[model samples]
Target: MENSRFWRDPAVPFIEARDVLDGRHVCYARHSHESFSIGAIVSGHSTYLNGRARHRVGQGTVVVMNPGDVHACNPLQDQPWAYRMLYLDTPWLTELQHQMGLGAHQDLRTFATTHSDDPRLFAGLNGLYATLTNADLAPLAKHSATIEFFTLAQQCLDPLPQRAVLAHDKLGRAADFIRANCTGEVTLAEICSVAQLSPSYLIRAFKQQYGLTPHGYLTDCRIQFARAQLRRGRAIAEAALDAGFADQAHLQRVFKQHLAATPGHYRAHSSIR
Candidate 1:
């Protein structure tokens, strides 16, 4: 039977979820997105294409795709395939890159291959999908699970660098401005003015120099501020607003993505010592 389930939360706007696809036989045409994507094969087999390369993937396989990396997947023969996937917006992926300490001047870093048979990644993704799709779970819990899952995934699947060195000074001023105004709404024009660069050039240069776009950098800073607030025993909702998040759920999502722990958990654990 062909079945699919999707989920989305306003707070975690940067992520779109296909929580499950069961017994689907639809063949997908070559396509690309402005977002990064990852899929976990739960059962059956399929042919995976990335750019000009092709490979067969089966149960326990993890597929990774970067933004605009043309790819598709279709079942071999009439075989049924079940899977779960997450589509992460570029800004979110950029924040992840920064969290992983990839540094500026690097392009999007992702898995070296289109797909991997690594059991760890499969298990980690499976767990994340389950947590994310479980309606009974609290936002904080789901956020924590998501972070933990990606942390494991990143550790197991070594990230490959995709670009050569670039100038860092170009965006230094813009980055500083964003960091300083991270807890507020910082506009693009403000950043461009500070950097003495045009919007387009600043966008490119900032991403190149910081491994994150200006908005991503701002989000990172807000997350950091939120973490400190949580550690200081601030209320979650208050921390969210104070840290420039739209709401507590947004804070939970971003915080978990970066820290692998929810604000509540972080506060609780921090208080334990």
Candidate 2:
């Protein structure tokens, strides 16, 4: 279909992914899968039903389905929506759980959470999707990222009986991390690791302390970087790429959102003597 895209590689056989840019017309009946499934709502809203539970999921919502869980999601009132889904082989994921020392080795680790809106978790999933689909990146990088993201998924989404206490002791360190990596690929896991904060704790407190979510702050940093470049009369597309935006249009959308002016307008005015 015109709205669908899929990414899978022979080197990474355990994972397969698909993203639907406009899924309002797409419909599905209640069904179960043999593999574990995780998905994020990229935009718009939908009604999500997993077994007896039902919830409305919007942008940034991450939904998890265990193997054989009957579930279905459809657009809310025919509204347009976009989403990304990743399915992992059950045995491979169960082995990963055992390797992570999450719990008993006998079964797939059940995620008590059917869904989450945690910004860190949401951003991590998007970042992972981007990485997994990248053609230039090495297979080893994709493999490492898959492991890192699922590990964080477990930490953020599953019920843990005895986890070590974590604190927001390094907000400055966190900001510095974002600033340093504004022009490169960065992950929520790295921010949590460098700041010594848990994923669940990092996003909310970072927003409270910095007045922006970690992803938001990163965008702001990139905007600032691009703005500085525009002041020097650099081209919009070049500035966008150097600032780590996906492309010029991405920079344009966000630049306008943050500055309330187009990049071209800003650059034209800034070049005045």
Top candidate on TM-score is 2
C-alpha displacement of 32 in model 2, angstroms?
1.1
Q: Candidate 2 on 49-87: residue-level lDDT in tens?
A: 886789999999999987645577888999999998888
Candidate 1 collision pairs? 105-208
Return model 1's CA RMSD, one decimal. 11.6
For candidate 1, the per-residue lDDT at 111 reads: 64
Cα lDDT for residue 99, candidate 1: 82
Error of 1 at 184 (Å): 34
lDDT of candidate 2?
A: 0.79
Q: Among all windows of ten consecutive residues in candidate 2, which has the lowest summed lDDT?
A: 159-168
| Residue pairs with backbone overlap in model 2 | none
Compared with the true structure, model 2 gives a TM-score of 0.58
lDDT (Cα, tens digit) per residue for candidate 1, span 90-132:
7666666678786455556756667878888888888877777
